[model samples]
Target chain A: MTINKELMKGSTVILILTLLDRKPMYGYEMSKEMEKSSSGVLTLKEGTLYPILHTLESDGMVESYWSSGEGERKRKYYQITKKGQGLLKEKQREWISFRTAVDQVLGGGPA
Target chain B: MTINKELMKGSTVILILTLLDRKPMYGYEMSKEMEKSSSGVLTLKEGTLYPILHTLESDGMVESYWSSGEGERKRKYYQITKKGQGLLKEKQREWISFRTAVDQVLGGGPA
Candidate 1:
Protein backbone atom coordinates (compact mmCIF):
# COMPACT_ATOMS: atom_id res chain seq x y z
CA MET A 1 0.00 0.00 0.00
CA THR A 2 1.11 3.55 -0.72
CA ILE A 3 1.45 5.24 2.62
CA ASN A 4 1.19 8.97 3.02
CA LYS A 5 4.54 10.65 3.59
CA GLU A 6 3.09 12.86 6.28
CA LEU A 7 1.83 9.86 8.21
CA MET A 8 5.23 8.22 7.85
CA LYS A 9 7.13 11.25 9.11
CA GLY A 10 6.84 10.74 12.87
CA SER A 11 6.80 6.96 12.56
CA THR A 12 10.19 6.58 10.90
CA VAL A 13 12.04 7.20 14.15
CA ILE A 14 9.99 4.64 16.03
CA LEU A 15 10.57 2.00 13.35
CA ILE A 16 14.32 2.55 13.38
CA LEU A 17 14.54 2.40 17.14
CA THR A 18 12.44 -0.77 17.26
CA LEU A 19 14.84 -2.45 14.82
CA LEU A 20 17.95 -1.29 16.63
CA ASP A 21 16.55 -2.58 19.90
CA ARG A 22 16.48 -6.04 18.35
CA LYS A 23 20.16 -5.91 17.38
CA PRO A 24 22.90 -3.64 16.15
CA MET A 25 22.64 -3.09 12.42
CA TYR A 26 24.37 -1.11 9.72
CA GLY A 27 22.32 1.42 7.76
CA TYR A 28 21.66 -0.84 4.79
CA GLU A 29 20.82 -3.77 7.02
CA MET A 30 18.31 -1.77 9.03
CA SER A 31 16.58 -0.59 5.88
CA LYS A 32 16.41 -4.10 4.51
CA GLU A 33 15.18 -5.56 7.77
CA MET A 34 12.47 -2.92 8.09
CA GLU A 35 11.25 -3.74 4.60
CA LYS A 36 11.29 -7.43 5.34
CA SER A 37 9.63 -7.13 8.72
CA SER A 38 6.84 -4.93 7.42
CA SER A 39 6.53 -7.18 4.36
CA GLY A 40 7.67 -4.32 2.14
CA VAL A 41 5.09 -2.00 3.63
CA LEU A 42 7.76 0.17 5.19
CA THR A 43 10.99 0.95 3.33
CA LEU A 44 13.44 3.39 4.78
CA LYS A 45 14.94 5.23 1.86
CA GLU A 46 18.70 5.83 2.01
CA GLY A 47 18.08 9.56 1.84
CA THR A 48 15.75 9.44 4.84
CA LEU A 49 17.43 6.76 6.96
CA TYR A 50 20.91 8.33 7.15
CA PRO A 51 19.75 11.67 8.47
CA ILE A 52 17.60 10.01 11.13
CA LEU A 53 20.51 7.78 12.16
CA HIS A 54 22.82 10.78 12.37
CA THR A 55 20.33 12.68 14.48
CA LEU A 56 19.68 9.70 16.73
CA GLU A 57 23.42 9.23 17.21
CA SER A 58 23.90 12.92 18.05
CA ASP A 59 21.02 12.78 20.49
CA GLY A 60 22.70 9.87 22.32
CA MET A 61 19.68 7.67 21.66
CA VAL A 62 21.96 5.40 19.65
CA GLU A 63 25.67 4.90 19.22
CA SER A 64 27.51 3.84 16.11
CA TYR A 65 30.84 2.16 15.38
CA TRP A 66 32.73 1.30 12.23
CA SER A 67 33.19 -2.42 11.67
CA SER A 68 34.59 -4.48 8.82
CA GLY A 69 31.94 -6.64 7.15
CA GLU A 70 32.14 -9.82 5.03
CA GLY A 71 34.15 -8.11 2.27
CA GLU A 72 36.43 -6.31 4.72
CA ARG A 73 34.44 -3.23 3.88
CA LYS A 74 34.03 -0.88 6.81
CA ARG A 75 30.39 -0.22 7.66
CA LYS A 76 28.81 1.95 10.32
CA TYR A 77 26.57 -0.02 12.66
CA TYR A 78 24.14 1.52 15.13
CA GLN A 79 23.19 0.09 18.47
CA ILE A 80 20.48 1.40 20.75
CA THR A 81 21.77 3.03 23.93
CA LYS A 82 20.20 2.81 27.36
CA LYS A 83 18.68 6.19 26.74
CA GLY A 84 17.32 4.99 23.42
CA GLN A 85 15.71 2.01 25.12
CA GLY A 86 13.99 4.29 27.60
CA LEU A 87 12.78 6.56 24.83
CA LEU A 88 11.65 3.61 22.81
CA LYS A 89 9.48 2.40 25.63
CA GLU A 90 7.94 5.83 25.95
CA LYS A 91 7.37 6.13 22.21
CA GLN A 92 5.80 2.71 22.05
CA ARG A 93 3.40 3.60 24.81
CA GLU A 94 2.64 6.85 23.10
CA TRP A 95 2.05 5.04 19.83
CA ILE A 96 -0.51 2.75 21.43
CA SER A 97 -2.21 5.64 23.15
CA PHE A 98 -2.25 7.71 19.99
CA ARG A 99 -3.64 4.84 18.00
CA THR A 100 -6.37 4.37 20.55
CA ALA A 101 -7.24 8.05 20.41
CA VAL A 102 -7.45 7.99 16.62
CA ASP A 103 -9.49 4.84 16.64
CA GLN A 104 -11.87 6.34 19.14
CA VAL A 105 -12.38 9.36 16.95
CA LEU A 106 -12.78 7.23 13.85
CA GLY A 107 -15.08 4.84 15.75
CA GLY A 108 -13.67 1.66 14.24
CA GLY A 109 -11.56 -0.11 16.81
CA PRO A 110 -11.58 -1.37 20.39
CA ALA A 111 -12.74 1.38 22.64
CA MET B 1 -1.73 11.37 27.66
CA THR B 2 0.55 13.93 26.03
CA ILE B 3 1.09 12.90 22.45
CA ASN B 4 4.17 13.77 20.42
CA LYS B 5 3.33 16.78 18.30
CA GLU B 6 4.97 15.18 15.30
CA LEU B 7 2.61 12.22 15.56
CA MET B 8 -0.33 14.56 15.89
CA LYS B 9 0.59 16.53 12.79
CA GLY B 10 -0.60 14.18 10.10
CA SER B 11 -3.54 13.01 12.21
CA THR B 12 -5.09 16.40 12.89
CA VAL B 13 -6.41 16.61 9.37
CA ILE B 14 -7.94 13.17 9.60
CA LEU B 15 -9.60 13.94 12.90
CA ILE B 16 -11.07 17.15 11.59
CA LEU B 17 -12.30 15.47 8.47
CA THR B 18 -13.88 12.69 10.50
CA LEU B 19 -15.71 15.14 12.71
CA LEU B 20 -16.88 17.21 9.79
CA ASP B 21 -17.98 14.08 8.08
CA ARG B 22 -20.49 13.47 10.81
CA LYS B 23 -22.03 16.91 10.55
CA PRO B 24 -21.29 20.57 9.93
CA MET B 25 -19.58 22.26 12.82
CA TYR B 26 -18.02 25.53 13.83
CA GLY B 27 -14.40 25.43 14.81
CA TYR B 28 -15.03 25.44 18.56
CA GLU B 29 -17.66 22.74 18.33
CA MET B 30 -15.37 20.51 16.30
CA SER B 31 -12.56 20.93 18.80
CA LYS B 32 -14.83 20.16 21.69
CA GLU B 33 -16.24 17.11 19.97
CA MET B 34 -12.80 15.83 19.14
CA GLU B 35 -11.73 16.13 22.74
CA LYS B 36 -14.89 14.41 23.90
CA SER B 37 -14.72 11.63 21.35
CA SER B 38 -11.07 10.93 22.04
CA SER B 39 -11.81 10.98 25.78
CA GLY B 40 -9.81 14.17 26.19
CA VAL B 41 -6.72 12.76 24.49
CA LEU B 42 -7.01 14.86 21.36
CA THR B 43 -7.44 18.52 22.06
CA LEU B 44 -7.20 20.84 19.13
CA LYS B 45 -5.71 24.05 20.39
CA GLU B 46 -7.08 27.29 18.99
CA GLY B 47 -3.68 28.14 17.60
CA THR B 48 -3.57 24.93 15.62
CA LEU B 49 -7.22 24.52 14.69
CA TYR B 50 -8.00 27.63 12.72
CA PRO B 51 -5.17 27.36 10.25
CA ILE B 52 -6.22 23.84 9.39
CA LEU B 53 -9.86 24.82 8.97
CA HIS B 54 -8.85 27.71 6.74
CA THR B 55 -6.63 25.49 4.67
CA LEU B 56 -9.31 22.88 4.33
CA GLU B 57 -11.72 25.58 3.22
CA SER B 58 -9.33 26.84 0.57
CA ASP B 59 -8.54 23.35 -0.59
CA GLY B 60 -12.24 22.77 -1.34
CA MET B 61 -12.42 19.82 0.99
CA VAL B 62 -14.69 21.86 3.22
CA GLU B 63 -16.75 24.94 2.72
CA SER B 64 -17.48 27.57 5.34
CA TYR B 65 -20.49 29.70 6.07
CA TRP B 66 -21.23 32.29 8.70
CA SER B 67 -24.02 31.30 11.05
CA SER B 68 -25.52 33.24 13.92
CA GLY B 69 -25.78 31.35 17.15
CA GLU B 70 -27.21 32.29 20.51
CA GLY B 71 -26.28 35.78 21.81
CA GLU B 72 -26.21 36.92 18.18
CA ARG B 73 -22.65 35.69 17.76
CA LYS B 74 -21.58 34.71 14.27
CA ARG B 75 -19.48 31.59 13.89
CA LYS B 76 -17.90 30.23 10.78
CA TYR B 77 -19.26 26.73 10.34
CA TYR B 78 -17.63 24.20 8.06
CA GLN B 79 -19.28 21.43 6.09
CA ILE B 80 -17.59 18.69 4.14
CA THR B 81 -17.83 18.66 0.37
CA LYS B 82 -18.19 15.66 -1.89
CA LYS B 83 -14.51 15.84 -2.62
CA GLY B 84 -13.86 15.98 1.11
CA GLN B 85 -15.86 12.80 1.70
CA GLY B 86 -13.82 11.02 -0.96
CA LEU B 87 -10.59 12.17 0.61
CA LEU B 88 -11.82 11.16 4.04
CA LYS B 89 -12.41 7.59 2.88
CA GLU B 90 -8.97 7.44 1.34
CA LYS B 91 -7.33 8.89 4.47
CA GLN B 92 -9.21 6.51 6.73
CA ARG B 93 -8.05 3.54 4.68
CA GLU B 94 -4.52 4.85 4.72
CA TRP B 95 -4.68 5.28 8.47
CA ILE B 96 -5.77 1.70 9.04
CA SER B 97 -3.08 0.39 6.70
CA PHE B 98 -0.44 2.60 8.29
CA ARG B 99 -1.45 1.51 11.77
CA THR B 100 -1.29 -2.12 10.72
CA ALA B 101 2.17 -1.60 9.27
CA VAL B 102 3.36 0.04 12.46
CA ASP B 103 1.85 -2.76 14.48
CA GLN B 104 3.63 -5.33 12.37
CA VAL B 105 6.99 -3.71 12.99
CA LEU B 106 6.27 -3.25 16.68
CA GLY B 107 5.43 -6.96 16.92
CA GLY B 108 1.99 -6.31 18.36
CA GLY B 109 -1.64 -6.64 17.19
CA PRO B 110 -3.23 -8.91 14.63
CA ALA B 111 -1.20 -9.58 11.51
Candidate 2:
Protein backbone atom coordinates (compact mmCIF):
# COMPACT_ATOMS: atom_id res chain seq x y z
CA MET A 1 0.00 0.00 0.00
CA THR A 2 1.13 3.56 -0.69
CA ILE A 3 1.94 5.71 2.29
CA ASN A 4 0.98 9.37 2.11
CA LYS A 5 3.43 11.92 3.45
CA GLU A 6 0.63 14.36 4.19
CA LEU A 7 -0.98 11.86 6.51
CA MET A 8 2.25 11.19 8.31
CA LYS A 9 2.83 14.90 8.75
CA GLY A 10 -0.53 15.23 10.44
CA SER A 11 -0.12 12.29 12.81
CA THR A 12 3.54 11.86 13.82
CA VAL A 13 3.35 14.43 16.59
CA ILE A 14 0.47 12.70 18.29
CA LEU A 15 2.06 9.31 17.90
CA ILE A 16 5.20 10.47 19.63
CA LEU A 17 3.24 12.15 22.38
CA THR A 18 1.17 9.04 23.00
CA LEU A 19 4.23 6.82 23.21
CA LEU A 20 5.91 9.09 25.68
CA ASP A 21 2.75 9.17 27.77
CA ARG A 22 3.44 5.63 28.97
CA LYS A 23 6.85 6.33 30.53
CA PRO A 24 10.13 8.14 30.12
CA MET A 25 11.94 6.63 27.19
CA TYR A 26 15.15 7.16 25.29
CA GLY A 27 15.23 7.39 21.51
CA TYR A 28 16.16 3.76 21.00
CA GLU A 29 13.56 2.59 23.46
CA MET A 30 10.89 4.70 21.78
CA SER A 31 11.74 3.27 18.40
CA LYS A 32 11.72 -0.24 19.77
CA GLU A 33 8.41 0.32 21.47
CA MET A 34 6.85 1.54 18.25
CA GLU A 35 8.11 -1.52 16.45
CA LYS A 36 6.87 -3.84 19.14
CA SER A 37 3.53 -2.10 19.44
CA SER A 38 2.98 -2.09 15.72
CA SER A 39 4.20 -5.66 15.37
CA GLY A 40 7.18 -4.48 13.35
CA VAL A 41 5.01 -2.53 10.97
CA LEU A 42 5.88 0.90 12.38
CA THR A 43 9.61 0.83 12.62
CA LEU A 44 10.98 4.29 13.44
CA LYS A 45 14.41 5.26 12.26
CA GLU A 46 16.72 7.18 14.59
CA GLY A 47 17.03 9.87 11.96
CA THR A 48 13.31 10.51 11.92
CA LEU A 49 12.62 9.99 15.61
CA TYR A 50 15.49 12.03 17.02
CA PRO A 51 14.56 15.23 15.24
CA ILE A 52 10.99 14.82 16.43
CA LEU A 53 12.12 14.28 20.00
CA HIS A 54 14.21 17.39 19.82
CA THR A 55 11.37 19.38 18.34
CA LEU A 56 8.95 18.23 21.06
CA GLU A 57 11.48 19.03 23.76
CA SER A 58 11.93 22.50 22.36
CA ASP A 59 8.19 22.96 22.21
CA GLY A 60 8.02 22.38 26.00
CA MET A 61 5.75 19.41 25.51
CA VAL A 62 8.37 16.88 26.62
CA GLU A 63 11.33 16.82 28.96
CA SER A 64 14.47 14.71 28.86
CA TYR A 65 17.26 13.49 31.11
CA TRP A 66 20.40 11.55 30.49
CA SER A 67 20.71 8.04 31.89
CA SER A 68 23.50 5.51 31.72
CA GLY A 69 22.83 2.16 30.18
CA GLU A 70 24.64 -1.07 29.43
CA GLY A 71 27.86 -0.79 27.37
CA GLU A 72 28.40 2.67 28.86
CA ARG A 73 25.84 4.21 26.57
CA LYS A 74 24.25 7.41 27.79
CA ARG A 75 20.76 7.83 26.48
CA LYS A 76 18.43 10.78 26.80
CA TYR A 77 15.19 9.56 28.27
CA TYR A 78 12.17 11.70 27.45
CA GLN A 79 8.94 12.06 29.37
CA ILE A 80 5.76 13.94 28.72
CA THR A 81 5.29 17.18 30.59
CA LYS A 82 1.96 18.34 31.95
CA LYS A 83 1.71 20.62 28.97
CA GLY A 84 2.25 17.64 26.74
CA GLN A 85 -0.53 15.81 28.47
CA GLY A 86 -2.89 18.65 27.85
CA LEU A 87 -1.84 18.84 24.27
CA LEU A 88 -2.38 15.12 23.92
CA LYS A 89 -5.90 15.38 25.19
CA GLU A 90 -6.71 18.15 22.76
CA LYS A 91 -5.30 16.25 19.83
CA GLN A 92 -7.23 13.13 20.74
CA ARG A 93 -10.52 14.97 20.58
CA GLU A 94 -9.58 16.57 17.31
CA TRP A 95 -8.62 13.21 15.87
CA ILE A 96 -11.87 11.58 16.94
CA SER A 97 -13.85 14.33 15.32
CA PHE A 98 -11.64 14.28 12.29
CA ARG A 99 -11.98 10.53 11.97
CA THR A 100 -15.70 10.71 12.33
CA ALA A 101 -15.93 13.19 9.48
CA VAL A 102 -13.60 11.15 7.31
CA ASP A 103 -15.58 8.03 8.01
CA GLN A 104 -18.78 9.76 7.10
CA VAL A 105 -17.29 10.93 3.84
CA LEU A 106 -16.09 7.40 3.14
CA GLY A 107 -19.55 6.04 3.84
CA GLY A 108 -18.59 4.31 7.09
CA GLY A 109 -20.18 4.40 10.51
CA PRO A 110 -19.11 6.71 13.32
CA ALA A 111 -16.97 3.91 14.71
CA MET B 1 -14.13 13.96 24.79
CA THR B 2 -10.47 14.45 25.53
CA ILE B 3 -8.09 14.86 22.67
CA ASN B 4 -4.77 13.05 22.67
CA LYS B 5 -1.70 15.08 21.65
CA GLU B 6 0.15 11.86 20.94
CA LEU B 7 -2.42 10.81 18.36
CA MET B 8 -2.24 14.18 16.64
CA LYS B 9 1.53 14.11 16.40
CA GLY B 10 1.43 10.71 14.79
CA SER B 11 -1.09 11.74 12.14
CA THR B 12 -0.68 15.47 11.41
CA VAL B 13 1.99 15.04 8.78
CA ILE B 14 -0.13 12.68 6.78
CA LEU B 15 -3.11 14.96 7.09
CA ILE B 16 -1.20 17.90 5.69
CA LEU B 17 0.29 15.82 2.93
CA THR B 18 -3.08 14.41 1.95
CA LEU B 19 -4.67 17.82 1.87
CA LEU B 20 -1.99 19.13 -0.41
CA ASP B 21 -2.54 16.07 -2.57
CA ARG B 22 -5.98 17.37 -3.35
CA LYS B 23 -4.80 20.83 -4.40
CA PRO B 24 -2.20 23.45 -3.77
CA MET B 25 -3.28 25.67 -0.91
CA TYR B 26 -2.11 28.50 1.29
CA GLY B 27 -1.99 28.32 5.04
CA TYR B 28 -5.44 29.81 5.51
CA GLU B 29 -6.95 27.58 2.89
CA MET B 30 -5.33 24.56 4.45
CA SER B 31 -6.76 25.43 7.83
CA LYS B 32 -10.14 25.98 6.26
CA GLU B 33 -9.93 22.71 4.39
CA MET B 34 -9.11 20.87 7.61
CA GLU B 35 -12.13 22.43 9.25
CA LYS B 36 -14.39 21.61 6.34
CA SER B 37 -13.06 18.12 5.96
CA SER B 38 -13.30 17.39 9.67
CA SER B 39 -16.68 19.09 9.97
CA GLY B 40 -15.24 21.87 12.13
CA VAL B 41 -13.43 19.34 14.31
CA LEU B 42 -9.81 19.88 13.28
CA THR B 43 -9.39 23.59 13.25
CA LEU B 44 -5.77 24.62 12.70
CA LYS B 45 -4.47 27.90 13.94
CA GLU B 46 -2.14 30.13 11.98
CA GLY B 47 0.42 29.70 14.72
CA THR B 48 0.45 25.96 14.11
CA LEU B 49 -0.08 25.85 10.36
CA TYR B 50 2.48 28.51 9.37
CA PRO B 51 5.40 26.87 11.07
CA ILE B 52 4.50 23.50 9.60
CA LEU B 53 4.15 25.04 6.18
CA HIS B 54 7.47 26.81 6.46
CA THR B 55 9.16 23.65 7.62
CA LEU B 56 7.68 21.65 4.76
CA GLU B 57 8.79 24.28 2.27
CA SER B 58 12.30 24.36 3.67
CA ASP B 59 12.51 20.58 3.60
CA GLY B 60 11.73 20.75 -0.15
CA MET B 61 8.61 18.71 0.28
CA VAL B 62 6.50 21.70 -0.67
CA GLU B 63 6.98 24.72 -2.92
CA SER B 64 5.26 28.05 -2.53
CA TYR B 65 4.41 31.11 -4.62
CA TRP B 66 2.89 34.44 -3.78
CA SER B 67 -0.59 35.06 -5.12
CA SER B 68 -2.27 38.41 -4.77
CA GLY B 69 -5.91 38.75 -3.88
CA GLU B 70 -8.51 41.42 -3.29
CA GLY B 71 -8.25 43.79 -0.31
CA GLU B 72 -4.47 43.95 -0.80
CA ARG B 73 -3.94 40.49 0.66
CA LYS B 74 -1.11 38.55 -0.92
CA ARG B 75 -1.33 34.92 0.03
CA LYS B 76 1.28 32.25 -0.39
CA TYR B 77 0.11 29.17 -2.20
CA TYR B 78 1.95 25.94 -1.60
CA GLN B 79 2.12 22.89 -3.79
CA ILE B 80 3.63 19.52 -3.03
CA THR B 81 6.81 18.65 -4.85
CA LYS B 82 7.73 15.33 -6.34
CA LYS B 83 9.61 14.52 -3.20
CA GLY B 84 6.55 15.43 -1.19
CA GLN B 85 4.46 13.12 -3.33
CA GLY B 86 6.87 10.26 -2.71
CA LEU B 87 6.91 11.01 0.99
CA LEU B 88 3.13 11.11 1.03
CA LYS B 89 2.90 7.64 -0.45
CA GLU B 90 5.33 6.23 2.10
CA LYS B 91 3.42 7.77 4.98
CA GLN B 92 0.07 6.47 3.75
CA ARG B 93 1.34 2.90 3.85
CA GLU B 94 2.83 3.42 7.30
CA TRP B 95 -0.43 4.83 8.65
CA ILE B 96 -2.41 1.91 7.30
CA SER B 97 -0.07 -0.59 8.90
CA PHE B 98 0.05 1.37 12.12
CA ARG B 99 -3.72 1.62 12.28
CA THR B 100 -4.01 -2.08 11.66
CA ALA B 101 -1.80 -2.86 14.62
CA VAL B 102 -3.52 -0.36 16.87
CA ASP B 103 -6.87 -1.89 15.98
CA GLN B 104 -5.65 -5.36 16.81
CA VAL B 105 -4.45 -4.22 20.20
CA LEU B 106 -7.73 -2.42 20.79
CA GLY B 107 -9.61 -5.65 20.01
CA GLY B 108 -11.04 -4.31 16.78
CA GLY B 109 -11.01 -5.88 13.35
CA PRO B 110 -8.58 -4.79 10.61
CA ALA B 111 -11.19 -2.44 9.25
* lDDT per residue as tens, model 1, A1-111: 667778887788999999998888899988888888887777889999999999999999999999966778888989999999999999999899999999989983222
Kindly state the fnat score of candidate 2: 0.26
TM-score of each: 0.90, 0.54
Off by over 4 Å in 1: A108-111, B108-111
Every prediction: chain A TM-score: 0.91, 0.83
lDDT of 1 by residue, B1-110 (tens): 76787888788888998888888889988878888888888789889999998998899999999997678788888999999989899899889888998999998322
Residue-level lDDT for A91 in candidate 1: 92
Best TM-score among the predictions, by candidate number: 1
Which whole-number lDDT from 0 to 100 does residue B12 have in model 2? 65
- Write candidate 2's Cα lDDT for B4-76 as tens digits: 3334554666677778877788888888777667666555678878888889889999999998766767888
Residue pairs of candidate 1 with colliding backbone atoms:
none
DockQ of each: 0.47, 0.15
